[model samples]
Target: MHSSAVFLIEFGAIILGLGLLGRIAGRLKFSPIPLYLLAGLAFGEGGLLPLGASEEFVAIGAEIGVILLLLMLGLEYTATDLVTNLRTQYPAGLVDAALNALPGAAMALLLGWGPVAAVVLAGVTWISSSGVIAKVLGDLGRLGNRETPVVLSILVLEDLAMAVYLPIVTALLAGVGLAAGSVTLAVALGVAGLVLFLAVRYGRLISRFVSSDDPEKLLLVVLGLTLLVAGLAQQLQVSAAVGAFLVGIALSGEVAEGAHNLLSPLRDLFAAVFFVFFGLHTDPASIPPVLLPALALAVVTAATKIATGYWAARRSGISVKGRWRAGGTLVARGEFSIVIAGLAVTAGIEPSLGPLATAYVLILVVLGPLTARYTEPLATRLSRLTRRHRPDTSAGDAPPALASEGPALTVDPDTAMSGSATHMTLPPSRGGS
Candidate 1:
């Protein structure tokens, strides 16, 4: 009873604090994610205060947060959208992976963390925060922008890659041999393929099966199904997040819309907790020691992400401003980065990875929104300045003038009438005939 009382008080305070923080962020026109992380830091191991009873509960909530994050992301598009984006935007995805992931891998190797840590860090840098990006899009009213599809396509491909990447990382961290790892990878791919196929073919029927007029029933059914699939996927050495995402992809139409509306609040609540949980795991003192490296990684990856987005958007024929927005929007690395680092930290792969990731995410998450709002305009200003200073070769050149006698019309000679007025006269010819 005493423990229960303590749990209630602690959890209640945490939620209330989160709500207030969110309110403040909303008023200030800022993301509440960094604030949540700060709150967790304050309540975590080396901070001003720490909670004893509610930690475990918060941990569970954090896991749900991640599952729901991925689930809702999957709900945002249909199976056809996913397949089409993969087919058409795969080059962008590849460019994204190559540009953003390399710096982290190189840094890990420079830090002497070995091949495993390099791979883990590469994943950390590769994925952008879908939750954050989605929120930014809604906040800034960029959901309907020309470049938004390109952005979503890249994000979807990253999430899909995570479905495979997480399992492989898990096997590697566990020291599984080649044969065992291959089996794990194969299982993950097979399950993902099967779920995708079902979603594409029978999505409507599946939606009907889960659909309910009652919001309560709909909510319960969708949440229960997601948790069940996520659990089973985890049991099979695949990512629980992937399972939840696939479950989301399998539901469309009214069912998806209803589920999205019903689960959005829950998603927001759990997602906040997840960010806090990430902060809870890191010690404040450890961050300063790794702050330099984290800052360096953040800066390098930020530019690479911008390049990746610009290239992708340009390829898709998005305008200059839209391409800049796409690049800036992809700069924030949040949930997935933490998720990847959490796995490495849990496996004791690298002692410093956690703190570095914490600091890195903090820097980028704060910078992300700023960049998204300003990058395009800033680029435009710089471009104008460059053009102003550029030498004008065209100033010395003159355009050819047409004959002043009258307006001249050019016609194709191949289709012109033979010997019948090659060029029309302004006035009818007098006695020249």
Candidate 2:
């Protein structure tokens, strides 16, 4: 009973602190994620003061946070949108995978963390934070831009990929045999296909069943259904987050919008807690040694994400500015990166992996918004500056006709009367002359 009091106090304080941090972030036009993570660090195991009473509860909340994150993400798109994005943007998805995934894998191998770790890290780097990117697109008033669709397409592909990737990672981290892993992978694929099929074929019916005139009942039903599916997905060696995502995709039209509206507050609260929970597990001291590598990895992957967005937007025939905007918008990796790292941390894959991911995410999540807001303008400014500073070789240099030894007489003063006849055909002069 006494311990319960402490848990309430600790948990209440966490909520209050997150609220304050979020308020400050809003005022300053910054991401509240870094602040939330820092708060967790201060109260984490190896930090200033760890909370024993609430750690277990925080862990549970963190899991729900991930489920809600994916669920809310799914609510944004219908099965048809996902299918459309996949069809037209698959090549871009391949480019995204190649450019972004390889760096994390190389870094993992360089750190001698082996193949499993490489795969985990590859995923960590490959996915951009949809939550963060959505906010960016909204905040920057680019939601309706031409390149927005391009960005969304790449993100959808990544999310769909996670439905497969997470299960493989789970099997790998669990040290399952090839047969077991194959089964797990196959099950994940089957479930994903089944969900999409149901969504596309009978989405209206599914939504009709969940739909409610009462917001409260609607909220409860959707949330309960998501949690149930997520739990089952976990039991089947698939990711709860993936299940939650599929649940989101299954709901369409007004049902999705209503659920999104109702669940958004909960999503924000739990998502913040989720970030904190991640930080609670990552030791602050472990970050310094890995800081340089994290910084380097962040820089490399930031560029790669930008490139992925740019290339995709270009392929979609977006203008140069829109391409730059798409690239910048994709630069931020937040919740999903931490989610991937948290799994590895839980499995005890590598001790330093958690801290490295923590530092890397801290850098990028904070930088993500700024990059999204500024990347296009900055790139344009740099290009203009470069052109301005470039050496003017044209100054005091020979004219085109005069520069060539093949011609001596250039413009005919008589022909110069007409603009089109300004330049006249000229014969070569004698070499001696």
User: Judged by lDDT, which candidate is best?
Assistant: 2
TM-score (all chains, Cα) for each model: 0.90, 0.89
- Clash numbers, per candidate: 0, 0
Model 1 weakest lDDT span, ten residues long: 424-433
For residues 1-433, write the lDDT of model 2, one tens digit per residue: 9999999999999999999999999998877889999998998978999888999999999999999999988887788877877787789989999999999999999999999999999999988987778777667755446676677778888987888889999999999999999999999999999999999999999999999999999999999999999999999999899999999999988898899989989999999999999999888988899999999999999999998888888887777777888899998888998999999999998998999888988899989998898998899899889988999787577676665567456542221343322132111100000
Q: What would you estimate as the lDDT of candidate 1?
A: 0.85
Model 1, span 17-118: residue lDDT tens: 999999998898877888988898899989889879999999999999989988887787677877877788889989999998899999999999999999
For model 2, name the residue pairs that clash.
Answer: none
Q: Per-residue lDDT for 168 in model 2?
A: 94
- TM-score of model 1 vs. true structure: 0.90
Q: For model 2, how many clashes?
A: 0
